[model samples]
Target: MVVEKNVSLQRCNTFGIAARAQALVRVRSVADVQDVLADPRLARTPKFVLGGGSNIVLTGDVQALVLKVEIPGVRLVDETDKAWIVEAGAGESWHGLVAWTLQQGWPGLENLALIPGTVGAAPVQNIGAYGVELQDRFHSLDGIDLLTGEAFTLDAAQCAFGYRDSVFKHRAPEAQHGAPRGFGLAGRALITHVRLLLPKAWRPELGYLDLERKRAEASVEHPSAQQIFEWVCQVRRAKLPDPAVVGNAGSFFKNPTVSPEQCQDIIARDPKVVHYPLPDGTIKLAAGWLIDACGWKGKSVGKAGVYDRQALVLVNRGTPQASVSGGEVMTLARAIQTSVYERFGIRLEPEPVVV
Candidate 1:
């Protein structure tokens, strides 16, 4: 139960924002969290559960006790004729889990490969790439209630997944957009393990245009899961800057969904506007296209800049010593949001949680 104080957090986050945690604890197991809860001084203190720090923006030094989740393990927990259920510790790298599953002959997770962050954070954001969302393959997850240190498990429906959102991302019923929205976990819970239901009769998801293009280029009519995995990696690598070389939190904004009327209005304004129709009749507009339309690509505001290749990505342009501050990143993000809204009449929601 060693509580470290004033720890540097510059490298902990993908944005490379200069920040620090006033007090931090590394939780390697469920008992570690129970220890934290049992401690007199720390029990009631405000706490922040940090995973890979891939989907967050630090506006300033974290004032709460930072519980860095580092639990680890992966195994095939169950198998049936329909699927293979696999479990992984929340602290495991998401991409590492995907690759490992593939190596073990699991195929459903291949479409979600190369996404940054830890497995625990995946359900928090309901991470998705290509055409597959975490909810699509989610079996169940085990977590601890930070307030009471009570352990529990939840199935997919209980997670309340919706468009890169989940119950864990909300603070109250009003803030939650998914079903059974009356309950919002937010900071109240800490995930320890996630189980995924990978189908035995696997099928490659090639619905996205980039994936379709890859298939055409490769001249493979029916691509294998491994091939699709490689293609997705290539597509993402070409558009997204590696967080190691250049600091970024992947897509900075969520693609805004609009009504049919709004989509028509935008189409009339700019016929070249990129959009995809949903099953529910709403249209999802590309946030990158909107930002690029507003001429934000390759532009910068102080130390925060939009990546040239992908307009949706907001990056830290400064070096390690003089890195971008969280405030700078938010400023640039707000500016981009304002511009895109002014031009397209659609408000873009940022994907990362601004801490």
Candidate 2:
């Protein structure tokens, strides 16, 4: 494994944020990772595991030795009468894997189409789109400890999947609030493989309003998995700016959940406030609606701006040569957060990792 110095990261992330890595290594195989760990000088440096770079905001040049995962493969690990266990290398594109599964006649994972990231990063954020989350289809994953060079595996429950959260998102101490010590994998492990269990009797998840509207437009009540996948892509293309054409990291904030009393108070003040009752009796508020109501859509803060179509998305308004800086992006994000919090008495949590 050759280590390169001063690597440009503008094309690495969906945001197209200009940044550089002091040193970077590409791990296309497990042996490459082993080589990195085995090296005396390299092994001593703090490392950063970079995936597709779709879900991060780089504040400045990365000082840690960057390990770019590029392991690649997809195969059926096993198939029971009940489900199909599909395994993929961590470096595979998340959307590509979803499409590949559908082409292979696996019906599940259609709802999570067009999520721009690598398979390795999916579980880190517990990525969810439409009505589906990664934990729903997750079986198990294998990762190598950065420090000890020890390999490990974890099941769905062991990951402690919460709303857009997992053990991979927290440090050991902060993550120890409920889970065990070795449980938190954030900044500690590099995922190598992920196995997904797709059920045989998969049912379509069309609870989202956009999907239902597509159903009406197409005049079909029950759609196939492929059809649902197409619908999701179509809906996303219309609602969200293409990261390729316009830099963005999909949804910029998590949909905040509130108590029933808080929901009632908001509802009383503005009855049109969009919300849904969660299974746990908490109410999930539409963050996009709150941002739009607060008059932030299409507004620019320096070179960072809110998308005109969807307020949940923040975009880089400058050209590649004059792209938005990480500080500008965070400034706009903080302003939006402050406004939403002040108006609704609810704090909005950022979705992207700020590095």
Candidate 3:
């Protein structure tokens, strides 16, 4: 394990925010992680496990050892005429895994193509797009106990995944022998690998209205799984700003779920309020529509601005040196929350884990 002192984290995070870490360690394997954890310096300080760094926003200098997971590889473990089970190292880039699966003719991940992040972080956030979520294909995950240095496998239920959240986010950090809760950090856990069960009988899921409209307009009689994957990529590219060029973690906020009565009241006030009815009779409102309706689309403060096309995304247009501070991002987020609350009496929560 190589440990570097006072590393600049501008490039490590997708947002390109300028931040410094007290110490940095790159872990390419579970053994490397264990070895690093044994270091006396780490034992005295906090440690942050990082993957692709696509979904996090650093507010200030991190006063901990940032472990960048670099483990890589993907493999097919079992296969039949109907389905296949595959496993991937947590450090593998998520989009790379999706492309590889498409090349191998696997279909379940097509809807999630182009989502930025590492495979290891996918289950923690239950990453989803179009109509598919990571939980829909999750088999299990191998996570290491930080204290005991032992590896444990957790099934899907143990993950406790729910709409962009998992056990990795909510559980207390001191639990030594249990599954991780809240953000894959905290507790004695570190995800080393993830297993996925994919379908062999691939079929296109045209659940998103815009995607369905595009397919209909194109007159695609029977789109293959790969073709659908390409379409999702194209649509995402057209809709979401690329973090490499514009710098953003797509969808800064999640669509808030509200009771049916609240949705009815909001709809009565503004008939155009976009919402979808949940199976349980609740309602999921369009967060982007809400933000745009509040006139925040294309708005900018300092170097950060809401994406003109997608109000749900906030982009960094200038250099990290010129960008807004963490406090500014929080202020803007709270403003959006307040605006949406005042208009519809529903609170909008951020999807990205703000640190």
TM-score of each: 0.97, 0.97, 0.94
lDDT of all predictions? 0.93, 0.94, 0.84
lDDT of 2 at 273: 93
- The predicted structure with the larger TM-score, 1 or 3, is 1
RMSD of 1: 2.8
Q: Give Cα distance to truth, residue 105, candidate 2, Å.
A: 0.7
Candidate 1 TM-score versus the reference:
0.97
lDDT of 3 at 296: 94
For 32-144, candidate 3 gives per-residue lDDT tens digits of 88787677867546678888888888889887778888889999988878788999999999999999988987778989999999999998899998888999999999988
Error of model 2, residue 102, in angstroms: 0.7
Candidate 1 per-residue lDDT, tens place, 1-355, comes to 7999999998899999989999999989999999999999999999999999999999999999999999999999999999999999999999999999999888998889899999999999999988899999999999999877899999999999999999998875553554334578998899999999999988889899999999999999999888998999999999999999999999999999999999999999899999999999999999999999999999999999999999999999999999999999999999998998788888889999999
Q: Candidate 3 local accuracy as lDDT?
A: 0.84
